[model samples]
Structure formats: C-alpha cells, structure tokens
Target: MKITKLETVIPRDIMPGLLALRIHTDAGHIGHGETYYVPEAVASTIHDWMAKRLLGANPLEIESHWRFLYERTTNFGSRGCELRAISAIDLALWDILGQVCDQPVWQLLGGRSQDKIPVYNSSAGPSYAGKSNEPHDSHVWPGHGCVGHEGPLNDYWSVVNRPTEYVQELLDEGYRAVKMWTLDFAAHKHGGPLYLSKQDLEVGLRPMRAIRDAFGNQIEIMLDGHGFFQLPTAVRIAKAMREIDPLWLEDVIRPDCVDTIADFRRQTDVPLAVSEMMIGMEDYRLVLEKRAADYIMIDPTWVGGISQTHRICNMAQSYNVPVVMHDCTGPLTLLSGLQVGTATTNVAWQETVRSQIRMIYPKLISGTIQVEAGYAHASDEPGIGGRWLPELFEGSTYQHRVSEAGR
Candidate 1:
C-alpha cells in the first residue's frame, strides 16, 4: 500500500520532547512511531524533508526507505535530529510491515530468540518524563539536590539520599540490577568534567558503596557517568568502582573517540558498557573494531530504529559482546527495544525506568507493557505493539504537523 500521509504530534503540556509519528497508507493501515528529545526539530525533519521520500512510496519497503533517507542525510551530516527523524520513520515502516503481514515485529524479525529478557532499573523519577511547557531542552538532567518530594517511583532522588532503602525496595520488587548517575553532580560542581576532587569522589562513591554494604551481591550496580568525565577522571572513577564490582560502568566518558575508550578500557578492571550516544551503524562499527566496550549499548530509537538496531546487535554478536538496549526516553523506544531484544540472541539486558513506565507512559499510550518479576516480555501484538492513545492527539495543547502525498 502506498503511503498517503505522514503526521507528527508533540504534546505541549507534558512530555514536550516526545514526538509521535503516524504514517497513513491507502490500505487502511496506520503505522505509529515515536522519538524523544528535540521534538520540534524532529517534526520539521519529518514533514519538511523526510516526508517527501516517504509519501507515495510502498509502505512495506522498509529497507529501501531506510537506505534512501540515510544516504541522503549522511552527505549533510546525519546525526542528532536528522537520524532521529529517520529512526521514527523506520519504526513506522516496520510497524506497517508487521500489520500487513499479520505478525508481531519480533516474529517478523526472524521470530523469538528468547521468551523474555531480564530488565535493569535506572534511577529516574516522574520528572524524568520531560519538562512541561518547554518543547525544547525537555530532558531532565540528573541530580535534583534535595529539590522534590519523596514520592514513590522517585528513585533518582531516593538513590542518592537513601541508597540502602532504595536498593532494598528494588530487591524486594525482583530487580536484579539498578543504574544511577550520582557522579553527575560532581561533574557539574567541579565546573566541568576535567577535574574531580578527592572529597567529591568519596561523596559520589557513597551511594554505590551503601548499596554494596546493604545488599552485597543481591543486586547488580551500574553507574552512568552521562559521558561527563575526561580520561583522567573517568579512569579514577572506574578505578574506584572496582571496589564495588559493578556490572558495568556505562558512558563514564563520551564515546567520541574509540581509541580513547580503548585506552580507558585497558586501564580499568571494571567492565565498561560503552554508550547509547553512538548514532548509527558506522559509529558502532568503530566501537566494535576498537574492542573499546565490554558490552555495547544501543538505543533503538536513537540508533536508527529496529533496522539499524538489529544490524548493530548482530555485529556486536560477531565480537562475542553482549547487547544492552537503552530506553530511558519514551514508550515506543522501550517497545521497539523489546521487539528487537527478544529477537536477538545475544542481547543481555533491557534498561527501564520504572518511574516513567508507571507514571508517564500510560498517559500517552493505549496498551500495557508486560513485566513480571524482572523480565520483560515482547508484545505479541502486530506493529510495534502499543499504539499512542487517540486522546493524546485530541488535546488543545497538542501541536500537529502533516505532509500529504502530491501536496
């Protein structure tokens, strides 16, 4: 079926960085996709540029459409919003393919590799959802510094202030792993990532040490540095983290230089999970080639959606390195990760912010994501599983942009 229209909606009141994309086809199938951060720019790319390549094209030709968009954008630098826009469109195309074939996305991607995958909790609160009213700069940076109330699911705040209690709660709830960004505060306090004092380093390690003291080996601890540290500081953090024996240190430094990451990895005993910041396959290829990361993190939405995610996962598999799906962004992002994570044999963990899943996700999407114990099951439903709620587009505060074929 030919694609007839492409539409995007950004919620102005809540979750402002979220952009919900819909591809309408002549065959009555409407495929849904979404990407987080920079909604206005992503929406513009979808309508003003990417829409022309998609309109009137065969909706099921997912690969051709993906390639066409990628090739054109790379000539002009394809990262950030451009690649994110392509990622949303790629997801929509796959969703349409799943619907047309009457199969779930996981099944369409070579059936299930596993029944379920283990999930790791990331310390995030409801405020992590997005900033209200602000369309741009919607991402919430870590470290509230005693700002908000101690509500349930406000794990980010709790983790720093009440580390022992937070670990106990997650352990009681069946989570085997938990990730935090407590070091970010030090990075900002030090004026930059260039330096970290002995005092601040001790402060940063306190929560992590508390978790190990209280729960010991009961829960796996992962530290996210938010790509904020320079080499010397990142090395120091990694060296200190060795005491706790974390599951992995993720993005302790940026993934900008594979050679530098390789250098860092050589210096530390702590296993490093490289990054989700790598935009596409080419970025990932270098990471794999350099042997930089012990585990590779891929954000399905940010890494060009399911198509590129699958390719990267396989490439990592070739290196015998496990894949971890990154999804602290949005529901479609989490759902898209599940679809591919369940189908990829080497995938190790799927990251989840329980706060976002329970507090923010239900407001925007229509279906429930099944997570029992610590394992998440892929949706058996066709086309990316959950659809964005019709009411999400009905609000007066929601902004809509569209591109129709032959316009």
Candidate 2:
C-alpha cells in the first residue's frame, strides 16, 4: 500500500513528551512509531525532512525507506536526531507491515521468543528516567535507581533513604532485579568535574552496602555508572562492588572508550553491562570483538530502529553476548523496545522505570503496554498506538502535515 499521509503526534501529558511518527496508507492502515526526544523538534524533522521521502513510497519497504532516510542525511546528519527520526519511521513502517499481515509486531519480527523476557526495575520515577530521590508528588524519574526515595517516593532516584524497605517492596512485587545509580550527583548535580574524597567515596558507596545487607543474594542488583566517572574512580567502584555480586555494572566508564571500558573490565571481576549508545553493527562488532562487556545494552531509540536493533542483537548473539534493551527514554521507546525484546533470542533483560506502572503511562497515552510481575508483555495491537487524543494536541499542531499519496 502507498503511504497516504505523514504527521507527528505528541502526547503533551507525557513527561518530556514522546515524538511519534504516524504513517497513513491507502490500504486504510496506519502505523505508529516513536523517537525519544524533544517531541517538537523530532516532529519537525519527520515532517520537514523525512515526509517527502516517504509520502508516495510503499509503506512496506521498511528497509528501503530506512536506507533512503539514512543515506540522504549522510552529509547533514546521521547519528543523533536524524537517526532518531528514521527510527520512528522505520518502526511505523513495521507497524504497518504487521497490520497488513494481520500479525502483531512481535510475531512479525520473529514470533514471540518467550511469553515474557526477564526484566529489571530501573527504580526510576514517572519522568521515564529513574528517579534519584523519591518525588514528593506522584512524580518519579526513570533515571538509574541509584538515588533513594524518602517519605514515600521522590524524584531524582539515587541511594534510597531506606534501602531495606525499598528492596523489600520490589521483591514483594515479584521483581527479580533493580538498577540504581551512585555517581550522578558528583558528575551531574555537582556542577562541574567529579572529585570524590575518601568520605565522598564512602558516601557514594553506602547504598551498595545497605542494599546488600537488605537483599543479600535474594535480589539481583545492578549498578549504573551514568558513564560519568573517571577511569580510576570507576575501577575502584567496580572492584568494590565485587563484594556484593551485583548483577552487572553499567556504563561505569563511558561506553565510547573501548580502552577505558576494557581497563575497567580488567580491573574488576564484577560483571559489566556496556553502553546503550550503540547505533550500528560496526560499533557493536568492535565492542564484541574486544570483549569490552559481558552484556551489551542497546537503546533502540538511540540506536537504529527495530530493523537495526534486530541486526545488532543477531550480531551480539553470534558472539554469544547477551543483549539488554533500555526503556528509560519514553513510551514508544518502551513499547518498541519490548517488541524487539520479545522477538530477539539473546536479549537477556529489559530495563524499565518501574514507577510508570502507576500513573505516568496511563495518563500519557491512548494505548496501554503493561509490565506484569516485573516482566512486560507485547501488545497484540495491529500497529503502534498513535491515535492520540485531541487533548494531547490542545496547544500544538503538526509541524507539517501531508495528505494521502493517492488523494
């Protein structure tokens, strides 16, 4: 079927907003896709830059469209928002293909690999990033759950004020794992450079000791480096975490530095979860060849779309490396990531800001994708949900809207 119209849908209610692609076709089918971002800009990129490329093209040509949008942007851009725009469109095209064939997106990718994959709570809040501190309001961030929440739940999750109680609640909820951060305050909140003194190091690591004391071996805890620490400090932290037997240490020394990552890996026996910033297979191939990480985290939103992500997963699978999909970006990122997670064989775990289960997602979108007992199930819906309520568009409108190709 020919693509008839192109538009961007933004659910204003969602924190930071989710910029989604809506591709309507002559076959009476519409596909939904998304990019993690500033919705307005991503939306503009889709309409102003990508729409004409897709307007009259066959909607089912996912790979062809992906290449077209990607190749054309070679000089101007490729990796960042340009790739993000293409990612959203690629997913939308897949949604259309799934609808055309009367199969769910997951099934079309490769059939359900498992009823549900194992998952780890990101200990984040409603912002889609894990919360560092418990939000006083209903809000919680989806940042790495490194920070703690006090007096209920708070924003900016770091080490929780009551690690014992928090871990207890997560275990009670049937969650098998949790990922929290311990280094962001020094790197992100403290203005400039990270300088951890002896006391600072102890304070940074206090949560790890508490979490170990609280859960012991019963619960799997993952540590996030936020990719913000110096190599020496990262190595020290990784070596220290060995005592707790963490599930994995993530982005400890920044992912782009293969040597630094390798050095960190060498210094500590702690299992490592490498970067999610991977975009193409070439980079993934190099990381795998170098053996920089025991587990590789891929954020499909930042990487390529489902198509590229699948390629990356298969590449990782060839090396016997486990793939972990990240979802702290936004709703479509979570949905599409889970779709890939459900269909891929090597994806060991899926990351989520667990707090979204409460109010964020329900209030943000017209569709629903739930995480049950710490695992997420794929939606049986024909296409990704993009029929946003008009209320979501109250003060906004599509940056550029295209009519049906055959109209």
Candidate 3:
C-alpha cells in the first residue's frame, strides 16, 4: 500500500517534547516509530526535512527508501538528526511491512534464533522513568550523548551504600547480569578538571570490589565509563578493574579516538564495549578492523534503525565479535532492538531498565514484554508488534501533533 500520511505526536506528559511518528497507509494500517531522544531536532528533521520525500511512496520498499534517503543526505549533514529521522522512518516502514504480511516483525526478520533475549539491568536507579521530562537532569543515571551532572540530594548510588546489596537485590529479582556507571560526569559534579584523585578512583572501584566479593562467579558485572576518561586514566581504571574481573568495560575512552581505543586494548586484557552513540559504519569499522572491542554496542535509534543494525550485526559476526542492543532510551528503540535480538544470532544481551519498563510499557502500548529470570521475551503480535494505545494522550497541553499535510 502507498504511504498516504506521516504524523508526529509529541506527548505532553510522557517526555514533554520527544517526538513519536506514525506512518499511515492507504489501506488504513498505521505503524509507529520513535527517533532520537532529543525532541526538537528530530521533530524538525522528520516533519519538515524528510516527510515530503516519503509521501505516496510504496511503504513496502524498505531498502530502496533507506538508500535513497542515505545517498541524498551525504552532503546535507548526514549524521546526527538526519540519520535519526531516517532511523525512525525505516523502523516504521518495517512495521507496516509486517502488518501487511500478517506476521510478526521478528519472523519477517528471518525467524527467531532466540526464544528470549538475555538481559542486563541498566541499574540507573529505582526511579529512572519519567525523568525524560527533565531528560538529562538525572541524579543517578549517567547521561547519553554528553556528560550530565547528578544532583547531590538523590545520589542513588550512594543511597544504595552497599554495591553487592544493590546488585544482590537485582539477582534476587531474577537478573543474571548487571551494568552501572562506575565513573561518570564526575568532573561536572566536582567542578574540577577531568582527573580522578586516589580517593576518587577508590570510590568508583568500591562497587566493583563489592560485587566481585559477593557473587564471585554467580553474577556478571559490566562497568560504564560514559567516555569519562583520558587514555591514561582509562587504562589505569582498566588495570585496576582487571583485579576484580568485570564482564567488560564500556565506553571507557572517548569513542571518537580510534587510536586511543586501540592503545587501551593493547595495554589491558579487560574486554572492551564501545559506545551506542556511533552512527556511522566506518566508526564501527575502525573498532572491528583494529580488534579494539570484544563487543559492539548499537542503539538502532541513534544509528539508522533495523536495516543498519542488521548490517552492523552481520559485520560484527564476520569479525566473530558479539553484538548487544542498548535500551536506556526510548521504548521503540528497546522494543524494536529486542525483536532484532530474537532473530540476530550474533546478539548477546539486551539492556533494560527493569523498574522503568515494567511499569511504563503497559501504559503506552498494547503489547506486553514479559521478563522472567533475567531474560525477556519478544512481542508476538504482528507488525512491529506494538499497537499504540492513543487514549493515554487524551488531554495533555504539552502534546504536539503533526500530520503530513505538514505540521
């Protein structure tokens, strides 16, 4: 069916300003997709920049549409919001394809290779949801894209006090893997340069030591560096953590510095996982070519949707490197990526904010993502598997709705 209209809705209560797009077909079928976390930039890119090209196009020609947009945007700021809009649209097209075909998206993705996706708790704290209103204004979780400060009053990490106790609680709730920021935006919080003191280093290490001591071999601990360190400092922390033996160290060095990442890999045996912020294949190519990281972390929403994620996972498989889909952002990203995980053999873990998702998901969409003992099942419904329940947005002043006649 031809795509007749493209609509965008900015939910007033949910994220206040983030954009969610719906692709409308002549057959009256609709598919939903969400772009990057930042609302204004992505909204403009989708509503004003890209919608004109999409109107009346064949919704089923996913690959052709994706390539057409990619080739044209090369000279027109190809990366940031531009790529994110393409990502949102690509995801929605796949959703429309599944609906028309009467099959779940994962089955269309080449059937399930996994029954459920292995998961790791984002450990962003007990109250990580709805903070998207102030999105980057967090007191416990590390920020995405750039470093963000956490206010002193609700420093959830400190509130937990005992790291093992914090982790054991997750284990008790049925999580086998756990990930948290060991050092992040500390420079912003401390009002100093990006150097960590002896005391500062120990403070970060305390949680690692606690988990290692408590579980030994039962739980896997992953550390998030949030691109917080220089190469030397990153190497030092990697060296120190080698004593505790983490599953992998993530985004330890600024992901842009390919040479520094290579250097860190050479200096220590600590397994490396790079940023989900990487949008270009060459950025990932450099890491894989140099054997810089043991794992590739991809956020389909940031990198261009299911199509790009499938290509990246295939590339990683050729290198014998594993792929993990990141979740600490939007539900569409999480749900779509998890569906990919069900079909992608090279995938290892899917990140989840347990407290955030279990409560918020039912309110926003029709499908249920059930998690049991550290693993999550993919949605079985046809299409992209999510049917948006619109009534939830009934009366919110902050909401903005735009249709293809043009917002």
Candidate 4:
C-alpha cells in the first residue's frame, strides 16, 4: 500500500522517553516504530525531517526507504541522530509489512530460530522517586533474590528498595541473571575519577563483592560502567572485578572510542561488552573487526530496528563474538530486542528489568512476553504483537505530541 502519513509519539517516563513513530498507509493500516533517543527530539525528527522524506513512498519497500532516508541525510551525518530517525521510520515500515502480510516481524526475518530466548533482568532497582538510602527492606524490593542493588544508596535503593533483598526476590522469581549500573554513585562519592584511589576501587567493588559472596555464583552478575571511565581506570576496575567474575563488563569506555575499547579489552581478562549506543551495522562492524569487545550489547531503539539489529548479529557472528541485546528503557524496547534475539544464533542473553515487567507489560497488545527460568519467547501474532495503551500514555511526562501534519 502507498504511505499516507507519518507521526512520532514520545511517552514520558523517568527512564528515557519512548520515541514511537506511526506510519499510516493509504489502505488505512498504521504501522508503529520507536527509537530510543531523548524524548524531546524523537518527535521533532519524525515530524520535521523523516516525515517530509517518507511521504508518498511505498510502505512495503522497507530497504529502499531505509537507504533513501540514509542517503538524504548523508550530508548531515549517516550515524547517530540521522540513523535514529531512520530507525524509527524503518521500524514503522517493518511494522506495516508485518501487519499487511499477517505475519510477525520475526517470521518475516526468517522463521523463528528458537521458541524462546534467555533474558536477564535489566534495570533491577527501585522506582525513580523512592528513597535511595531507605533501610534495606526485603518486603519492599521485588527482585531481591538476584543481586542486591549496588549503587548510590539513594538512587540504587530507591529503584531497588533493599539491594540484597531484591536479589533474593529475583532468585525467587526464577531469574538466573540480573544487571545494574555501578559507577554513577561511586563516581559521585569519590568526587573525581573512578579509579584514582584504592578507596574508590574498594567502594566500586564492594557491592559486587557483597552480591558475589551472597549468591556464590548461583546468579550471573553483569556490571554497567555507563562509559564513565577512561582507558586506564576502566582497565583497573575490570582487573579488580576479575575475581568476582561478572558475566560481562558493559560500556567500560564509550562506544565511539573503538581504540580505547580495544585497549580495555587487551588489559583485562574479563569479557568486555560494548556498543550499547551504536546506531547501525557499520558501527557494530567496526567494533567486531577490531575485536574491541568479547560481547556486543545492542539496543534495538538506538541500533536501527529489528532489521538492522539482526544484521549486526550476523556481522558479530562472523567475528565469533556473542550478542547481548541492551535495553534499559520501556517494554517496547525489551520486546523488540527479544524478537531479534529469538532469530539470532549467537545471542548471549537478553536483558530485562525484573521489577518493571509488571508496570510495563500490561500496556502491550498481547500482554507481555513470558519469561520463565530467565528465557523469553517471541509471539507468533501479527506485527510485534504489542500495541501501546493510550490510557497509560495520559498524564505521563514522558509523552510528547507531534503535529498532525507529521502523521
């Protein structure tokens, strides 16, 4: 069918807002796509840039439209925000294709490789407003059984009531792995570089050690440094945590600095996971070619859509590196990532926030994808099998409205 209109919607939330794009066809079917960019800009890019380029185009020409948008933005910059905008449109095209053909996105990619993909609990902490230092309470935290929330007491505990308590809760919930951001609070407390002092290293490693000692390797622990360190400090921290044996050290350095990531990989024996900020297959190609990391972390929202993510996985497969989909935002991201992972052969494990599942999943059209024993199965339903709940969108600070012309 011919394309009629394009629209972008940003749903407000404490976490990064949802950058959703809706592509309406002349036949009256609307397809949805989302990007993981800052909320304010997501809507603007769709309305001001992508919508103008995509109008009157064929909805089923997914690849042509992707390249057209990419070529049109080449003078600006092929990566980053340009790719993010293209990603929203690309996902929308895929959504339209799936809906029109009466098949799921995964099925269109190539039939399902596996029924379920293993998922690790992501964003395993407290809600945005909770007290960070509130005394650890087992009853309050949801995923206490996995690994205690480890970060600044206030931010960490606020999202994950009691650190250790939530770890225990995760274990009870049958989650085999959990991930949390580590350096933000430690960096804040030190008031300088992260690895500047022995005290800083100890402070940084304490929460992880506590969890390791408590769980005794029963659970897989992953640490996200959030690209907060330089090469030297990242190496030092990775060395210190080598004994604790994290599943992977995430974004130790920025994704753009391939050389630094390669250096960090060389200095530490622990597996390095990088590229959570990557936007396309070429970005992933550079990391894989350099052997910059042992594991590649891709977020579907930032990394073009399910289509591009699948291509990146294939590229990573050539390097013999495992892929771990990185999703720290809302339910749409998690579900989209899972769809790619299901069809991927070299996937490490998917990430999810054990606590937010209840809050986010109910808004989906097909409810939520089920995760049992740390694994999730993709739905066979048409499209992504999830629809946004407009009621849930009401009064949310994360939602941004686009002009009707954009749609």
Candidate 5:
C-alpha cells in the first residue's frame, strides 16, 4: 500500500507541545503515531520536509524511510525536532505494518520475551508537565516547581511533603520501585546545579532518608538529577545517596560527556543510570564504551521510535546492560515503550507516572495501558493498540496540518 497523505494534530490543551501524526495509505488503513515536546516544530519538519519522501512511497518500507530521513537530517542535524519528527513517522509506519500483517507491533518485533514488564512510578502529578496557565520559564531552575498540586494523585507533592506516607501508599498499591527529584529544588536554590552546600545537601536528603527509615529498602528508590548538577556536585549527591542505597543515580550530571559521567561513576559506588537525555545510538555507544552506566535509560519517542529503540536494546544487550523505558511525557511514548520492552529480553522496568496514566491518558488515547499490581501487561491488539482520539482534532483549539500526495 502506498502512503497517500500525512497529517499532524497538536492537542496543546491536553499536553503542551505534544504532536500526533497520522499516515494514510491507499489500502484504506490509517496509522497513528505521536511524540512529546515541541509540537509545532515537529509538525513543520514532517509536513514541509519529510512528507515529500513518504508520499507515494510504500507504506511498509519502515526501515528505508527511517534511514532516509535520519541520513538526510544528519547532513544538517539529527537531534531535537528533526529526530523527533522521524520518530513519529517511524512509529506510524510500524503501526501500518502491524495492521497490514494482522499482528501487534510487539509480535512483529519478534513476540514476547517476558511474561510481564515491571514498572516503576516516577513522582509527578497530573499537571507536572501538563500545559499550565502560569507563565514561568521552567528551565531557569533545576526543579523550580517540583512540588505541584496537593492531591491524592500528586505524587510529587506527596513525596516531598510526606515521604513515609507516600512510600506506604505506593507500596500498598504494589509498586516495588519509585523515582523522584528532590535534589532539584536545592539545585535551583543554589543557582542552578553548579554548587550544593552542606545545609542544602541535608535538606535534599531528608525526604529520602525518611523513606529509607520507614521502608528500609522495601522499595527501590531512584534519584533523577535531571542532568542539572556539575560533576563535583553530582559526586556529592551520589555520596550522600549511598546512605539510602538507591536503585541508581539517573542523569546526575549532564550526559554530554561520557568521560565525565564515567569519572563520576568511578567516584561513587552508587549504580549509575545514564540517561534518556542522550539521544541517538552514538551517545549510547560512548556510554557503553566508557562503562559509564550500569543501567541505560531510553525514551522511545526521544531516541527515534520502536525501530531505533529495539536496535538500542540489542546494542545494550551486547554490553550486558539492562534497558529501562522512560515515559514522563505523552501516552503514545508509554505505549511505544511497552511494545518494544515486552519483546526485548534485556529490558528491566518501564518508567511510569501513575498520575499521568490516571488523569491525562484517557483524554488523549482510545485504549488503556494495562498495569496490574506493578507490572505492565502486553497488548495483542494489532498496531500500537492505542491511538489518539478522533475528537482531539475536532476541537477548535487544536492545530491540525495535512500534506496530501499529488496536492
């Protein structure tokens, strides 16, 4: 079947900067795909540039399309908006392929290697990264508004305000692992992540200590530094985190320098999980070569898509490193990760925000991601199973763009 048209829908109201792509083919099939962050730019890349290559081409040529878009983009740049657009297109192509073959994407990618994928909750409220009315530049500080919204599903606030209670609640709900960024508040207070004073160090470590005191390693704790801290400060945070014995220190320092991360890893015994921030396989290859991270974190939508994620998983397997799926963004990202993670044997745990799953996902997608206890169940439905709701584009506030073949 030949691709006939490409369409992009931006539901900025639901999730700011979330872009969803729809690929239409002559075979009477439409496939849906999505990526998080910067919807406008991603949409432009697809409609203006990538659409010419895809239109009238075979819809099943997933690998060829990925390579073409990636190789061509690399001539200028590969990361950020260009790669994100390619990721969305690749996912749409895979979705089409899955439907054409009458199988799920995971089955197309060699079936299930594991029975169920374990999931870890990252502390975020429903509105943590959601489109906000407040006009504040979030990047200026490490974690400026770390604690947002005080409610039952506001795990971010609950984790910082009542650490032991939050831990008990998560344990009662059957979550064995949890990740949070309490240090970012202090990192912001000390003028970015360059410096961490003795007092602020104590301040940041308090909640974590509280959890350790109450739960005593019953649940694995992960500290996400958000790539904010410098190497020395990251080392100090890692040294302090040793008392709590976290599952891993994730992106404590920026992922730009694998050598520096390797240096930080050498200084601390705390297992390092370096980074969803590092995009593409080249960055990951350096991390593996340097022995920088014990565990590697990858965001399927951020890296490329299912094709790239599967490839990276195999690459990580060669290094004997476990892959952790990252999704602090949109529902499609979570579902895409689930599809690849289910088929890959070396995958450890899928990152989730229960708040987002509960509050935001239902509004955007047609199907739900099954999470019973703490494990995510794989879906056998053809294609990605869940897709962006038709009503999303029907609204007046949403932005929709289309590029049709022969137009």
Candidate 6:
C-alpha cells in the first residue's frame, strides 16, 4: 500500500521526551515508531522537517524512504535530531510492514536466534543519592508478573547513606548483574570539573570494589561513568576499575570524538560501551568502523528504530563485536528494543532500568516480557505488543513549535 499520512505525538513528560509517529496508508493500516531527543522541542522540529518528505511516499519501500530522508537532511547534519526523526519513521514503517505481512517484526528481520534473549539490569542498585533502598519506590511496583510472568527484581534503587546495604539487597533478590553510576554528578562541584578526580576515582571505586568483594565474581557488575569525564580521565578511571572487573564501562566518554574513543579503547583493557546518544546508522557505522568500542550500544528510539537497529546489529556481527541495546527511557522504548534483541544474533545483552519498569508496563497492548534467570523473553504477538495509554499521559504536558511546513 502507498503512504497517505504521517502523524506525530509527543507524550508530555518530566524532560523533553519520547515522540511517537503513526504512519497511515491508503489500505487503512497504521505503523508506529518513536524518536527520543532533548530540549524537549526537538521532537516538533524533527516531526515538521520529516513530514514534508513522508507525506506521499511508498511506506513499504523502507530502505528508499530511509535514504531519501537521510540525503534530504544532510545539510542539517545527521547526528542528533535529524537521525532521531529518521529513526521514528523507519520504525513505524517496520511496524506497518509487519502488520501487512502478518508476522512479528522479529520474524521479518530474520527468525529468532533464541526464544528469549538474556537481559541485564542496566540500572539496578542504589539511587543517585546513594541510598540503600530498592531502585524503585513503593508506587512504582505494580506487583510481580503483572505484565505476564514473574521476573527477577530488576530495580535501580539509589542509597545515599548505606552503600553496603544496597549491594546486599540486590544479591538477596537473586539478581546476578546490576549497574550503578559510580561518580557523583554533584561531586563535580568540589573539583574544577565534573570528571572523576584522583580522589574521586578512589572514592568511586570503593563501592564497586566492596560490591565485588562481597558478592565475588559470581555477580556481574557494570558501571555508568555517565559521560562525565574527558578521554584521559575516562581512561584512568577505567584502568582503576579494572581490578573490579566490570562487565562493561558505559558511555565513559562523550560520543562526538571518534578519535578520542579509539584512544580510550587502546589505553583501557576494560570493554568500552558507547552510543547511548547516537541516532542512526551513520553513528553506529562510525563506532563500528573505527573499532572504537568492544560493545556497541543503541537505543531503538534514538537509533532509527527496529529496522536500522537490525542493520547495525548485522554490521556488528560481521566485525565479531556484540551489541547491547540501551533502555533508559520509558516502556515503549523497552518493547521496541526487545523486538530488535530477539531478532539479533550478536546482541550481548539488553539494558533495563528497573526504576521505570513500573511506570511503563501498563502501556503494553499484548503479549508478555517474562524475565527469568536474568533474561527477557518477548511475547509471540504482532507489532511491538504495546499501546499508548491515555492515563500515563494524564498529567504530562508537551510544547510543540513546528515550522509551518513541518506542521
């Protein structure tokens, strides 16, 4: 069928957040996709810019449509907002294609490598304050197995006062892997910059070391440097944490400098994880081609949806590099990433923020994502298996300032 309409909806949220696109065809089927960006205003900017080209194109020609959008926006640059827009449209097209063919998106990509892909708790443990409490508050837990089946507790609780207690809690919950932000964002105030200082590095690795010592190698620990350091400092910190033996060091340096990433990779023995901020195939290509990272990370919302993610994963597989899908956003993002993970053979693991799980699970339309023994299983359902619930957006507010043409 031919394309007839393209619609965008930006769900109002705490930060400039998730933008959803609905692509309608003459045959009356609509596909769904989402693009994640910031300044909150970029959503509307991208929506309007892409609308001009997408209005009457053939929705099924996913590759051609992707290229047209990419070339048309070359002058605007391809890294951030433009790529994010492309991602949303590309994803919606995949959704439409799946609906038309009567198959799950994963099957369309290629059959599943495994029925369920193993998932890691990307953001479990303590909160930013370093509190010992569970990653989520009381309101967030909707009860175990509410979505489909009972899964392990994958929460990202922050403990401000008791760091040791936090580690104990996760181990007690039967969680084998957990990720925590070591350097304090607020701690940057004490130093001239936000990066870890010599003292900061000592302080930061203490908790990680303690957790490792307490739990031993049986537990896989991950650290989020949060792009808080320059390349040199990042290398130093990664080297320092080598003793801790982290599963991966995440987004340690800014994504802008490919050369710097290469430099960091050369200096550190730790497996570097990059690309939480990347938006499309070009960004993924740069990271892969440069050999800049041991593990490539892509958020489906930010990185041109399921179709592009599949392409990127295939490329990574050729390089013998594994991919870890990033999921620090809402539920739609989690489900979207799940579709890609199931179809990908080289995916290392999928990231999940237990703190946001409670807020996101209710939005699912069908099937269930059951987590067992630290792995996630996708439902045998069509589409992404999720729906946009009006109640989730009840108190949410969004501001859209699209150019007349973009609108």
> Judged by TM-score, which candidate is best?
5
Clashes (candidate 5): 0
lDDT for each residue of candidate 2 in 1-407, tens digit (9 for 90 to 100): 68888767665445555675678888888777777766677777787768778888898888888887878987886777888888888888888898898877788887888778788877655644422233432332234323443423442343456566777777787787888775555555343124555556566667768878866788888888777777877777776777778989988776777877877787788989887876656678888898889999888776778888888888899999999998876667777777887888898898877567465666555777666787877677765533444454344543434444544
Q: Which prediction has the highest lDDT against the true structure? A: 5
Error of 2 at 281 (Å): 2.8
Give the per-residue lDDT digits (tens) of candidate 1, residues 1-407. Answer: 79999989997565877899989999999999988888899999999988888899999889998889999998998998998998899898899999998899999999999999999999987777654221222233533232255776888778888999888888888899999988877776635589888789898899999999888898999999888888999998988888989999999888899899999999998999978998878888898898899999999888898999999999999999999999888899999999999899999999999888888888888888766788999999888998888877664467887799988
TM-score for each model: 0.96, 0.88, 0.90, 0.86, 0.97, 0.82
Q: Over the stretch 108-214, how does candidate 6's per-residue lDDT look in tens digits?
A: 77878767766766544212111123243343222111111122333432322344666566556555777776564323444413455677677667777887777
lDDT of 1: 0.87
lDDT for every model?
0.87, 0.72, 0.76, 0.69, 0.87, 0.66
User: In candidate 3, what are the lDDT values of residues 167-243, reduced to their tens digit?
Assistant: 77778879888887756645345531256666767867787788888788788888888776778778778878887
TM value for model 3: 0.90
Off by over 4 Å in 2: 128-159, 189-194, 384-407
Write down the TM-score for model 5: 0.97
TM-score of 2: 0.88
The residue-by-residue lDDT of candidate 5 on 1-407, one tens digit each, is 79998988887777876898889999988888888888899999999999999999998989999999999999999999999998899889889998999998999999989888999999888776676554445654312445765775888888889989898988998899999988877766646578889888887789889999888878999999888889889888988898999999999898998999999999999999988988889999999999999999998888999899999999999999999999988887888888998899999999999988888899998888777788997678898888778888675567889899999
Model 3 regions lying over 4 Å from their true place:
126-129, 132-160, 189-194, 392-398, 405-407
Q: Could you give candidate 4's per-residue lDDT for residues 62-148 as a string of tens digits?
A: 888777777777777767767777777776777788889999888888878777888887644444311233354443322222234
Give the Cα error of residue 331 in candidate 2, in Å: 1.7
Q: Which order, best to worst by lDDT?
A: 5, 1, 3, 2, 4, 6
lDDT of 2: 0.72
lDDT accuracy of residue 133 in candidate 6: 30
The candidate, 2 or 5, that scores higher on lDDT is 5
The C-alpha stretches of model 5 lying farther than 4 A from their native spots are 134-145
By descending TM-score, how would the candidates be arranged? 5, 1, 3, 2, 4, 6
